[model samples]
Target: MLDQTDHDDNEPSAPIDMLEAYYAAHNWEFERHDDEIVASIKGSWTTYELRALWRDDDSVLQFLAFPDIKATDDRRPALYEAIGLVNEQLWIGHFELWSSSGILLYRHAALVDGEEEPMLSLSGAELLVESAIEECERFYPVFQFVLWGGKSPREALAAALVETHGEA
Candidate 1:
């Protein structure tokens, strides 16, 4: 029965508490499993499974977004190259491919320490989820171009870098 109103101003909000409040306010559907909150979000190009968890010590908040795409053996090299290229330009979080399952995930972490608890906001949690989705939207086409379109790694990345401008 702990709702948003249950949070006391005098007490520091735990990471999961903040996340629940934020997600509930935004009307996003998620399941709380143990220490993790799992949600399915639809991006521009695909749907992603997003998970948020707090460390056992409650010092770190971790967010991970996994897309539906999986790299095959023949596509692994190009995907790796593209991941490295995309990661270099990112300010927060990084893309990683699990070798065993070829699963690609975007990972980000927010560190909570000292007096920073008072400063945490809902926007911060939203930013973490949004950033992961944005990264996936921005770079997923490169994987598609390389794997399905049979383009070289360089060409695929180049294609993805082409930005479209609309009339303002």
Candidate 2:
């Protein structure tokens, strides 16, 4: 097992570039990379897990797992819930990857909050749902698709906006 606490001095591969190479056939672009996590290519969506021990090298790692068409429904709602907290002091999240059989396998832990009690906490289903919703928003009208239970990117993001701003 790899030591989670070990921080390799090597630079972690840029998630954007890695994702781009993996989905070269689709409309791809780098979105964000903070800390050890990165996201890119809003369209032609596929998730990737590091294939080998990156050891903090110059931004190129292999990851085999991708999005599963089956987990879209059961997981989207939880994802939506997580996105709602993005602006809150308690919100922290990552991309939830799953197998084609609908079983969740991995997640890319990206966001985090440093509050005393940490306001945001999400169920497994919620994480999957949020990741899918995130893709829809980034990919938009060009790559129209929904992965969550009944919430599409349009609905989930809109609701998040409303819930966040509306409550204020």
Candidate 3:
């Protein structure tokens, strides 16, 4: 129940309230990062991720987010969810979903120096893994269903990826 019903584009009060409610239910703390809202959760052994939000030029909503991850040696892009504000318009973003673990790998879009073109770069694997481990500790059931044999589905798939790329 996100409140995107306000007629005034300048006033983003409703959406803010919806986000607050959503996070509160999940036991996350929400904070303001410039013009965006960041939601964070705390854990014992691992650190939680910071989910972020903002508005596009058309008043469409955008989420700069991450999936729960485990610490790995690979340097790869993470998955992110870019849900559309309304039904018609598509909110564009890229992410790699781990079918086994049901974890998402997100790459946040960043402003490159002296470049007009927007860039989506891979976040640090350490951070991503820490976030994922925290999430797994908090929500074990979902992760259990998503992953197989205590590993994300992507791990199983990675073997094939090497063969596909002729690395084998």
Candidate 4:
């Protein structure tokens, strides 16, 4: 059962329990600490540390997927530029650099009105997690290009954004 804390007028707030169900149904290993669910998901490009936190006060569930990307202080300017270019091409969610930690993560927030059912259903979580992992897989190499391969932000984005139809 989802634990919902009451907000003003005793309306039910967001719940993180759905994510637990999501993990179980997919047979994915995860640990729940308080209002957060942490899981390591393996993608085609790399593994991602996925964290889903529910904020009862705001009735929002936030998804954070880290692709293990890091950048040196000298390359942060380019890293930021690359993130912006990468975010522009995304239809959902966005990428952020936790400059202090030098880590890059993809973040998306789902909002619930807190009047009816839970904000994020188990089915919804399935889509969110899968989509996030796919996004991380698709763009993990772009960050690699900019941070290590000495590729410009625009160049990296252009190269990764290319879509190939039919495998050779």
Candidate 5:
């Protein structure tokens, strides 16, 4: 638990310390880029680039997960439709298409108020990162189905949403 007394709104501690501690605790390798930390997370579908950054001005922590796939011009329409459907079902974060590059990414953010406890802020950061990664893993297959398997957007989403039964 983080003690409230350990943090002061006027004299807030550096955000990097909390982020580094969390990554170290999880034993996940990461690279620091100025105020951002970048890591690669391997999922069933593919490796995802996870980037976490803190905007001190806004007191917001943002996490983005980019998968190793790109949508072609023709596939953009279907992919966009699937993205909308998937984003609608997501509890946290939303999928976005980079129109310029045709790359898709999942993005989530946590706002940290200076008045709150540092631990609370750190926890929010962790949740944002975890949620982004989880959502990426959950939806990557749908993108793959549409992009490579020639499945319609609706069919790909349905395939991705299918639930399996446990062994009897």
Candidate 6:
């Protein structure tokens, strides 16, 4: 059994180790190198690149999910508006467009601090990752519609947010 209280000098490896355990438990194939866990999870609309980095200095685990695509310059304005509207409805995390890459992604950070010992747990990791996946699955089409469908932000969002009852 791995010791949960083994936070030595705020080493970054501890969080990654915990995440390794979490991935194993969920049967997820992931690559661990340095302070990051890299995995690709397939969603309803696309495949997401899950990049989780352990920030040793800040004691934060930043989890990012990229949707395997990037925004073009012409679509930037509409994409930005859609992101704002989507972000307003998100309760846990928000979406961001990396300036240099123009890649869209979901961002969430979890503070790894334990009162008695390290608070890092598999359940916590699962919660954060699952939440990102859920949000990504729900809103992915809004990006696609605006970026590729030649639709306005409002139109794209409305089409994506429409509720369908029961299985078709």
Among these predictions, the greatest TM-score belongs to: 6
Give the lowest summed-lDDT range of ten residues in model 6.
Answer: 1-10
- lDDT for model 5, please: 0.77
Candidate 5, residues 9-126, lDDT tens digits: the string is 4234456656665565566788987879887767788888888788877877777889888999999998999899898898778998999999999888767665654333455546
TM-scores for all predictions: 0.84, 0.21, 0.34, 0.86, 0.83, 0.87
How does model 2 fare in lDDT?
0.34
Residue 81 in model 2: shift from native, Å?
16
For residues 1-168, could you state the per-residue lDDT of candidate 3 as single tens digits? 222332223232333344444455455677865546666665553445555443433333344444355422231222111111111121333344555554554433322221332222122222332344443343333223334334343442332223343554
TM-score of 3: 0.34
lDDT of 4 by residue, 96-160 (tens): 99968888999999875545555555446667887888888888888999999889998988888
**Quick one: RMSD of model 4?**
6.1
Lowest summed lDDT window (length 10), candidate 1: 1-10
lDDT of each: 0.78, 0.34, 0.38, 0.79, 0.77, 0.81
What are the per-model numbers of colliding residue pairs? 0, 11, 13, 0, 0, 0
Per-residue alpha-carbon lDDT of model 1 for 1-168, expressed as tens digits? 234343445244666766676666656687897778888867788989888888857578888999888999988998898888878879999999999999889999888664645234555666777788888888889878977899887898889898789975
Give one digit per residue, the lDDT tens place, for model 2 in 26-140. Answer: 3333333332223343234554332211223332222222333344565645544443433232233333334345433223333322233212222221243345445434433
Rank candidates by TM-score, best first: 6, 4, 1, 5, 3, 2
Q: Candidate 4's C-alpha lDDT? A: 0.79
Clashing pairs in 6: none
Off by over 4 Å in 6: 1-13
Candidate 5 clashing pairs, residues 3+ apart or interchain: none
Query: Which 10 consecutive positions of candidate 4 have the poorest summed lDDT?
Result: 1-10
CA RMSD of each candidate after superposition = 4.4, 15.9, 14.2, 6.1, 4.4, 5.0
Which regions of candidate 4 are displaced past 4 Å? 1-14
